[model samples]
Target: MSARSQRPGFGWAAPATVFFVAFGILPIAIVAYLSLTRWNGLGSPEWAGLENWRALPDDPDALNGIKVTFLLTLLCWLIQTPVSLLLGVWSAGRQRSRAILSTVFFLPLLLSTTAIALTWLSFLDPNFGLAASLGGSSLLSSPHQALYAVAFVIAWQFVPFHTLLYQAAARQIPTSMYEDAELAGANTLRQFFAITLPQLRNTIIASSVLIVVGSLTYFESILLLTGGGPGTATRVLPLHMYIKGFVGFDMGFASALAVLLVAVGTLLSVLIVRSTGYYRMASDREGFL
Candidate 1:
């Protein structure tokens, strides 16, 4: 082969490569370094080796944060995925009602996260808020109810995005398949179970990866809604990291948590991709899974 032909296409990839190195690789390298040292964002970092990492196992608040983070991840998967799938399936058909319903379902995504959190915060406020009329304590003030309420808000905001994903995937299925299923004496529910769900497996897997990773990093809404209040009841890993780094002035420990969060998210994503046979199906363009 000619030298010219053997030359890699650096011209085409240079921009993206530069961006990845500058923004992605550089920040991660900094974080990795900071995770090994004690620095309170202002002073010179003092080398601490593995001290911060070792402390994670014995840290009660950190342990609780991990538990809460995983709980939120599971709750989001269970609640958002199914509901999004149903909405997507129902809206895949061209109907006026479906269009209206999809619009209503997606309206929440239009608002900012701060707005959504604050709105829910008001609704859950016991004094002069909507929940006041419910005649009991505010849900946000209750440790048991706070986490679930926050999870619901997160799911509500993102469900539309997931629904759009599934809707697009579902719509790509050939109409002939449904016709064949109808001719085979399949009912609507039977068709969905045999065909629609099967066809959407890859989409579901992909969406689940996004949701799981997002759940791990959810912070803003939680911060605004509950401030990880009611005594750490709703504090997730990201929120805990923020508190450690900024609020508590424990940057080293916070960096360790951040690294762990990234590691966990990456691990889960890889497992999902592999277990779902995503790599094997990647080259298939026919789209009929």
Candidate 2:
């Protein structure tokens, strides 16, 4: 007689599980199998065993990619978190101005990643873009600035998404907590740290995990913008893998790199969830129930 009992059984989940297996597990398995063999999409895959994995240690681009990947992740976190958090918090206010401004702020989320990257690429074009107006200097082509340029663009494309996350999370925080803090002589800044920060803790952890993991897979934007150029200054792991796989036709080595990236992304996610106690945190709604 219970409503829970009326719900369909595991049959409803079958479609999702099938889709995941077909798209997710299947490709990973194919890639794992390819990692042990040499192929250039010319003929049948030849068995190369651990040759590709062994070569990773000696590959200069792979090493540089690891370094650059970490650096980008750090920069992205440094840039996106504070800005998104502040914007999200400010927008959570029930005001017409905040609503209108937040709508404009989140408009970037409507654009595709490729569109954003290409648009910025034009702006950074040395000959006729925004750079031409400034000093004919292109950040995308600068050895010292290309990485930062890429980071800025990445932030520009994704900050709206993460800000949406924070905004929703901030809204879920009880308003009564702030009212109580105000009654206790706590100023606005004091209330934020005591009430807002603590409440948004889980959202922050979830967003950080997403940002860090997503940083590992940012190939298209970098490809469209810098092409990992300016003397390998912006070639992260995914881009390097892409070059080896698609550009050089070295499928075997590329598969190995892909496996390594998958492993790292998985491990990093696990570590963050465990360390932050995010998995153990319970929902406020569940407490009410």
Candidate 3:
């Protein structure tokens, strides 16, 4: 048979499209409808008719949630990308010790998120955790320090995953490129800047999109760690939405926040992809091939 004759048809996408509509698009549609009605997780939803949407402009917590979410997202990118890049490049070396150490470094990604959060929660406990043992003032209880602490813990948890991405991408850089640079008397640092970073451009953009969008749903760690506590210092959008919907029983407003969350995450991912031309999956070696 001709290659074209055996190619998958449009029918191949039906299962995935149906699944996305049922679970993904359908949930968003329901939430959008819920945002227009006042539901308290009890009786039938009353027609709120933009009351929740209008209040979003004046809601202190919602606004702060947006700010904090972006702040954390930025922090994650700043903390993870460079560290991951450095470690990934280093670990890409074909050495026994590098492989062994890379395995250890990736342990965090293997652990359960709840277990990791709870472990950190205990470590940061003011009374008896490691933070107290260090004789430093309680990090988690201090509003000024808690957010930064959370960001650090987030980096600790997620950096390994991104590092793995960079490692794979780094290893794929044609050895000849580095050899050519070496022939030209380029130093390690110069070769990295000129070759590694440029070739990994696509991976960086892809990883960044994941980090920004994933930051929106960072509910469990913050929930388990601070419970949006120390007076809303670490209360990100997801936790803020949870408090409104479940704790405050303002489901309609929370639905609005969820819609906002969806909009912001989608926009951010789309913007990055569009701006960087990542959607084309452009190769750094386009002409080098």
Candidate 4:
């Protein structure tokens, strides 16, 4: 073959390559470099070796932020996934019901995060709001209740997105399989276990990865709704990072935290993908490597 023909599609891949280099590779490289220094977002950065990284374990705020982040992730997963799956299954079974309910469920997703947070804030207000009649205690002000309340709102906004994903995946399942199960006198629950769940495995994995990664990086809504307070009760890692970088002006420490956040997110994504055997499934179906 000619040298030109044997070469890869460099011309076609140029834009994507440039974008990845500029946005992805460059930022990660910069953050990794910055993590090892002590800079206050002014003057020159002084080399601090691994001091910031070492301090992370001992830092109460960082530790609490990690705990809160994971807790929020767990709550979001528990609240959103099953409900989305159930709604997806239900909607898939009834076309007419699907149209109406899908619209209602997805409406929240169309609104901006700020708008959703503001709306929920009003609803949860202690006076003259919907929660006022329920003993009139402010949910957002109580440290114990604040995290869960914020998590619920986040879940409410995202559940429909997952539901739609599951619905699409469910629709891809062959109808004949369900018919065969029915012919054998299988009920809805039995058929679901035998057919639907197994077929939707890949979809579930994809949705879960998205949810976990998103949960880890949650910021804007939490910032607007709770401001990571009632004494740092709902302060997640991203919020902590923002406070450290912008508010405290500890650029280097925040960069270290940022790097750690990226590491944790990447590790979680990899572990979930591996455990779910997503790559193997993809390779089997599409000959992907």
Give the count of colliding residue pairs in each prediction: 0, 0, 0, 0
Q: What tens digits encode model 4's per-residue C-alpha lDDT throughout 1-289?
A: 2466777887889999999999998998998888899999889999999998898898898999999999999998888889999888777766686688778988987999999999998899889778997889889999999999999999988998999999988887878888878999999999888788878889888989999999999999999998999899999999999999999999888998999999999999999999878976652222111
Per-residue CA lDDT of candidate 2, range 123-209, in tens? Answer: 999899999899887887788899999999999989999999999999998877877778888999988897888888899999999
TM accuracy, model 4: 0.91
Q: Please give the lDDT score for candidate 1.
A: 0.90
The total of clashing pairs for model 4 equals 0
Question: Number of the top candidate by TM-score?
Answer: 3
Candidate 2 error regions (>4 Å): 1-9, 284-289
Question: Candidates sorted by TM-score, descending order?
Answer: 3, 2, 1, 4
lDDT (C-alpha) at residue 42 in model 3:
92
Per-residue accuracy of model 1 over 1-289 as CA lDDT, tens digit each: 2467877787889999999999988988889899999898786999999999999999999999999999999999999999999988888999888898889988997999999999988888889888899886788889999988998989889999999999999998788888888998999999999888887878998899999988989999999999998999999999999999999899999999999998999899999899889866653324442
RMSD of 3: 2.4
Cα shift from native, residue 133, model 4 (Å): 3.2
Give lDDT tens digits, candidate 3, residues 130-244: 9888996898999888989899889999999999999999999999988888999999999988888998899999899989888878889999999987999999999999999
Where does candidate 3 stray beyond 4 Å? Answer: 1-8, 286-289
In model 3, the clashing pairs are none
lDDT of 4 at 175: 85
- Which stretches in model 4 have alpha-carbon errors above 4 Å? 1-13, 283-289
lDDT of each: 0.90, 0.91, 0.92, 0.89
How much lDDT does candidate 4 score?
Answer: 0.89
